[model samples]
Target: MGRYVRADGLDIWTEQVGTGPDVLLVGGLGDTVESWHFQLDGLADRYRLTAFDNRGAGRTAMPEDPVSIETMADDAAALLRALDIPSAHVAGFSGGSIISQELALRHPRLVRSLVLQSTWPVPDAYLRRWGLFIRWLAETAPAERTFLEGFYLDIYTPRAHNDGTVDRFIEDVLAFPHKQTTENLNRFLDAVLDHDTTNRLPDIDVPTLVLAGGRDSTSRPELGRAVADAIPGARFAVMEEEAHQPFQEIPDEWNARVDAFWRATQTRTT
Candidate 1:
């Protein structure tokens, strides 16, 4: 079952399942908890899985003001506290990775471990390129459509694209009611563009796992390694034949890695 509560003045919606250590799943920009449909079934039987929509997306409150990953991260902490969960394993994908990072950095006590996927330490060049793309996307429908089409190229292998999975992803995005405002999207893109966590990576004290898709262009496996290498004890892995959305592209393997990591961490803690 699911519950809705206003935490820190924002309407927060969440669903909890399973019976083990709490696992909070955070999705990327313009994504909802529904994004984890595949992974949920894969691991819920072994985890107290909690998935929710980020602010300004899905069923959560979308305030008039802009929101930052830091604020969103705090929201995450508040949700846990409200649920009486002292600590939990936090997992984030793509843009969600930024929230995960800030959560660990700003509210260390709430996060027992982390799973960061298809993410990177923000660099100025990355931000600049992203800004240009967002601006272009806002200006031209042709460009936006092109951008959406090209987005798959960055994340999936040629083989997966050929198999019609990538096509279905685009269809799903179109099917979802979620849509970001030019202002909200811009601010978010700016935050990501301005992000630079390289120096602070060493400060993360939790047991971390960094994952990347072999064919991902946005956050390549090499970048994934950089993140893993930055964390003192973080482990890094790559999903072969996969792209940006590893969990969606290869659900079985993605779930296996997540399941194994949580299981090992749980054993160690208990």
Candidate 2:
């Protein structure tokens, strides 16, 4: 448990383990730094891992009206600068991936390498439909099973979704601190949907690893392919039998691939 003051007047909650090249882990929407619990423990022995909650989630201060992806990217850059880390390997899952891409694009000097997982470049169709669902849930089903069911379908393996495992999943989400305000959630979701770096991806000089889940319905395989195709020399990998929560579903495989990717990139850079 550690706290770092960000440049944006927000006291960020962060935790670190091990000591090596910095590896910053950012979670998706409404997800706390605790969402990377498995990754933190898995990578702690080998790399310097930093996991933190974004604004409005976990212990971080929630700033209103100023929570765009650009601002979130700025927050990430500020976190690194505050740590005196000139550059670091950055990784994010789902919605967090947008912030990571923005950080790489807008604050290129602060990003050494990028790991994007279960993410897409924000397609218009997906945004229009899913964004509406988010708004509806926030307004009608705040903290209810309806929200969990829909979210699980979007973020979990089909097997998990079909297994009648709603209780535990809802419990896990309820464990986090969320406002369930449509405006707040929509503000973040819109920022994510509005962010598109496809045209600028080829210009990103940093090494990138694009990861996807074989069974992901939200950010499908095609999305991953598009991302890899856009970014020059970006490596793409899909976890077999996994979904949006691949890291949690298959920790061994996820860790092995992530560790290998980091080591290979580190060697190539050095």
Candidate 3:
């Protein structure tokens, strides 16, 4: 069932699946809980997976003012509190990873383990340019096909495009109901561009696993390594055949890696 959790004056759309140790799934820019559909069944048997749509995305209400990563982090923490969850293993993708970092930093007690996938600690010139390009596309050609095609070009590898995987992905994206508005897209882009957590990463004390896609030009493997290196004892792994969205591209492999890391963390804590 779908429910709304009030956080930071916004009604955030949240969904919970399975019943076990809590795992919070935070999606990327313009992504909703639906984006984690591939992971729902994969991790459900071992975890009580909770996912929510960030402000300005999905069924969640847009903020009256521009929102920052810190604000979104607080929103995530607030959602957990509202649900009476004391702590959870947090996994975040792309922009969501930045929010996850802030969550761990600001609300340490709320995060038990961290998974940062296709993430960057700070925005470089290349990333800034790409963010601007996405904003331009959102403003000029916000059609489903245009956006999906652009995303396919950026997030998937040539192997995926050659094997009709991109075609299938486009169809899936078109079927999704909650599409971000141009204004909200721009706002999200702005927030992502402003995100800088390089200096704060060392403060994240939770067990962390940084997953990088070798072919990810969006946030490159090097960036993921940097994030892992900054965090005291964070472990880093690269999915050589995947691109930005490894979880979607290689669900079985992705789920296995995450499950192994979560289990290891649990063992260590116990």
Candidate 4:
């Protein structure tokens, strides 16, 4: 059910399921197609959904060449073209949302609609410093779980940690075989560090929905508001109960929200 499609000079590992209007789901930093298991399972019956690994993550082997958000956007465009999809609804999480912005700007024809979750228009001073620190931590941390502990603390709410969600995820990461190398993680972070679409967001004329986690410190709600305000006619909302990952933590709620937006876009466009 999973396979590789050659795109942007490398074999991009991708998974496609169900049928109907196309939906491309892009994951956050270091995420693979597997990161979207909930969506692939929940929304596939109604929409054709495809998820893939970014250039420097997952089964898509990190290339020796430099990586950037712009190039990764190009990769997503190539993946759609290679799959014979003229255009589709595109949804992205965190870093993936940054790439989605670039994809919509660089290849506007390839994006029918955008669902940007936990996104920001650009990294502010605090966020830039945070990115640097995270990259440094990834490179110097003693153990994988050590870094993940810190990461989990920053991303998930206290409720998740207390409810055993964080513990279960740590175990899942530890048991996963396709561990992302620190080198690849740093590269991906570099791409995120360089992402800035503040000036260009207005150019994106497609139907766009920007969702923010009210408790997210990394990509704060203010940042999401700025992005929404910059983009012409884009709608913005907040999932107050979620932190960085509502789709994983509350799949049903997340799926219903995005599905409503996607179908509404289809209706208006058709």
Clashes of each: 2, 0, 0, 0
- Backbone clashes in candidate 3 total 0
The pairs that clash in candidate 3 are: none
In model 3, the Cα lDDT at residue 226 comes to: 93
Task: Please give the RMSD to the true structure for each candidate, in Å.
Answer: 2.1, 2.0, 1.2, 1.0
lDDT per residue as tens, model 1, 1-270: 556866888788787778877899988866777889897777877888888887776778678765677788888988888888899999999888888988999999999999999888874465367656755666564644465676556667787779988788777777677565556656666666667788998999999999988777677788888999999899999885678887887788888898889888887888
lDDT of 3 by residue, 184-215 (tens): 87887799899899998999999999999989
Q: For residues 53-133, what per-residue lDDT tens digits would candidate 4 score against the true structure? A: 887677888888789999898999999999999999999999999999999999999999999998998899988898898
Tens-digit lDDT string for candidate 2 (162-243): 6745456677767655443456567777778777877887878889999998887778888988888888899998886888
Model 3 lDDT-worst window of ten: 135-144
Model 4 TM-score (2 dp): 0.98
All candidates: TM-score: 0.91, 0.92, 0.97, 0.98
Q: Which TM-score value belongs to model 3? A: 0.97
* Model with the higher TM-score, candidate 2 or 3: 3
Considering TM-score, which of the candidate structures 1 and 4 is the better prediction for this target?
4
Model 3 bad stretches (over 4 Å):
none
> Relative to the unseen true structure, what is the Cα RMSD of model 2?
2.0
Candidate with more favorable, higher lDDT: 3 or 4: 4
lDDT-superior candidate, 2 or 4? 4
1 or 3: which has the higher lDDT? 3
* Stretch of 10 with least lDDT, candidate 2: 176-185
